[model samples]
Target: MGLRTDPVIFSVSVALTVLFVGASIVFTAPVDALFGTMSAWIITNLGWFYILGVTTFLIFLVWICFSRYGRLRLGRDQDRPEYSRLTWFAMLFAAGIGTILMFWGVAEPISHFANPPQNNVEPQSVPAAQQAMGYTLYHFGLHTWTIFCLPALCFAYFVYRRGLPMRVSSIFHPFLGDRIHGPLGRAIDILAVLGTVFGVAVSLGLGTLQINSGLTALFGVEFSKPVQVLLIAVTTALATTSVALGLDRGIKRLSDLNIALAVGLLLFVLATGSTLYLVRGSIEMVGVYLNWLVPLAFWNDTFGDTGWQGDWTVFYWAWTITWAPFVGIFIARISRGRTIREFVLGVLGLPTAFTLVWFSVFGLSAFDIELNGPGGLVQTVVVEEDIPGALFAFLDNFPFASVVSAVSVLIVIIFFTTSADSAALVVDMLSSRTQEGTTPVRQRVFWAVTSGVVAATLITATGRSGLDALSEVVTVIGLPFFAMGFLMMVALLRSLNDDTVPEAVHHLPTLRVHLPRRRMPRIPRIPRPADGEPAPGSPRWIIPRPGGPGTERPGPERDHSE
Candidate 1:
């Protein structure tokens, strides 16, 4: 379980990331322009794919839940879940979308409210307000979770269920068999690493922006490149130290702290701000989201102006897809031993519910202040382009403004650390040749530092266009993995169908159960081997008896050549 580094992947990933960061810093203007143009090209041409592919993934996951294979466990039938339900849920919520929610919960609604999504809706009107909250919830809702669900489910099924290595390429085993260990598989793992590194680094950079803004708002500190770099360096060092300490002692504790602070922040806003409005608005928004979900989910903006769609909806889908590798693998790694049904429902439902509530509290609070209270805050956000300050601006209107604002800053820092450390673990797994346990401390530390340095370098080099470059990089880089997402879903279904575990049979109403005197119980028969004996490593059929004391007892094993 010591450091078993895969030299090819580990070196190549680090070298490429360092080189890109160096080039971007040395050639700032050209690199910025290059990323901007490339991003535009991808969004303009293939934005539709990002939209439809994500929608398809959501639909595919739903089908899996209701299908016969839903009862299949991610691990062996006798194996119970590793982490308890509460810890598992908490960890997933924190690592999954905590940072994004911290970054955008306040700003996005205000941005949308100031400029409504549709052409006809008057900006800042009552309808605009409703739609703004609705759209915010929509963006962070089930759609985003589905992006994590598909890959997580696939990876879990392959690794825990089939006894394969915990690698993205393992998802192809149903299709490629042992070829999963070949060049194609290694290529897939490399792509996963690419997504993980870029996505995590960009997130680290973006979170730094929010933290920088928090400092400027609270302490009157001047925002500068040096300051931003310093923040990244400090936080990255903390994150790296946590990673070196390992998952149980480090990341889990950080995640728990994040969730606790997040809850405190949410409650303060709800109590200080409009409690009744936030509550009513949340209920109504949930209804509105459900009503509009189908149309919104499938809407690609083909007929009218596609600009807004590309900027907001399409960009969001791309961001989630880009982050899916890190988030998915992180979720999968922590979610071993849970049943498929439990995993799907918990991952998709709980986080989404939390997102909706959190967004409604913060987003609606800002909207209320804009509509009725002192209105300069929304203007500050819109006219001044001070998104990083939006949360602080909102907090300014509440009681104990300074205290809450400082707490918000702390929440952001913790969220940033949790996201970075979790991503480091995922990247370490993807790059390492080790079969199990956490990646070695050395590999984890290398990735952690590399991620932070890359982020700070890119931000320093590109200036205002730093985010645009990150966006485009993720959108473009996510395409190949996006395609793999679909294939992984297919492979999951195939593997589940052929699995030795019998599909759970729903017995139709029978007369035998009604008359018990002399009735022989109807035994559910198992399918026989297709030819002779079952293949080596394949599970043997186990016939289930009706009304038996031990219904799950194993039956005779059929030889493959029988």
Candidate 2:
């Protein structure tokens, strides 16, 4: 079939993209200045909201795990899972983490070590290393994934179990009812489209810059806006091709390949670098992360001078919340026929465990080099301000830096491709009136190219400053959307209670009835007792009900006539 799309969603989304891009190009300086102010204001005023919102998402998901509603199936009770646990987990891990891990896994810990959150910990000391790991874990751990999990759980339950359209506003059905199809619903969806598009664009922009840096580090290619733009064009074409190929053939395959390459790269570093130190550091940091997670999550720099929390933690919350719709909807689309418990555990637990290990390996390698080996990464990153080159510089310490760097570039590019392609499909779904079938090739390519264009335009217009501004832009947009997430959690719980489960008798022992059958004395067609009266001549044999004791005693009961 041709590329079918919703006229309103497609037109509004396209017009907004054009206007933003054109204005950004024509008035670059003003746009940059405005976004900078907006970002600064958001961080200054609403940083607390972002922190508490993310923490609440984690707590809510964890509560759902132990709630009676956990056993509820996302789909009909009889429906079996569409994919096996391993495949499901792979998709979850791949889509959820994306290129952020590649970009930050090594650099984040080093950055944290260089600039410790609290002055109490000496910079670049053992204490700094522990605290750094805790910060990185805090950013990427269960809390962040909860942002993705909350909406995913909501969308999955509404679409798969309740037979609603798979859209952002659908999760608000309980709160909005038929109003989900009104102007308010459209507004919610439009925000989702903008959030996904701009969010993905920012990620693409950042990934391309990192890829460019890797290229320069490996092959001495000069980094330029034109080169980065060209990088976006080529990779976006690959993403367009993947979108054309559809999810099973394109996204799924690439995700599987990316996982393999990621694992291979991790193992290579583990084997060549200080393997023992990485392993030991991972264990110790996990302990520290757990110990500090509670206090750190609730901290808001209120009584202290921890502006760094706003910079890192609040920014992370904004980023994750902004990207939740795309990531969450994509997760919902793939995760069908799984129970609430299964979805929550897999979405919250599996990806987090993998992220911990992934960070442990790469993060500790950079830490080891900085502390024990010849130390230059902290100087390169903090002093020199060359963030993109951090990963390649860390890899240069080991043998075959060029080859591994090349592999890292490819992994990053693929991660970018998968993220862009998946995001395109999601945009199409959000804008489309129909939600059952695959998005059309033309629509997918349109969104795919539009995202690349925006990324390139933003980077070309404002450079890294513009990118930072865009980060705040999403944060500002994400606050209201984050409120909807709480509604989704409430809606999910309500729906779970109202909807019927197919396997209720199995999961819920209370639903199983075990009333004893009464044997009446072979009386054929005896007159039935009136309401509230026992069966004729069977009062002594009346069976007790399952829920509680029977109204009349089994042995005897006095009639009102007496």
TM-score of each: 0.87, 0.88
Collision count for each candidate, in order: 7, 0
Report clash pairs, candidate 2: none
The whole-model C-alpha lDDT of candidate 2 against the native structure comes to: 0.85
- Can you write out model 1's per-residue Cα lDDT over 416-475, one digit (the tens) per residue? 888888888888888887656455688889888888878887777776577567767787
Residue 442 CA error for candidate 2 (Å)? 1.2
C-alpha RMSD (angstroms) for model 2: 11.1
Per residue, candidate 2 scores C-alpha lDDT tens digits across 172-284 of: 99989999888888888888999999999889888988999999998889899888989999889989998889988988888889988998998999899888887887787
Q: Highest lDDT among the candidates is held by which one?
A: 2
* Model 1 alpha-carbon miss at residue 429, Å: 0.5
lDDT of 1: 0.83
**Can you list the residue pairs that collide in candidate 1?**
532-560, 533-559, 533-560, 533-561, 533-562, 534-559, 534-560
Runs in model 1 lying further than 4 Å from the true structure: 1-3, 500-562
Model 1 TM-score (2 dp): 0.87
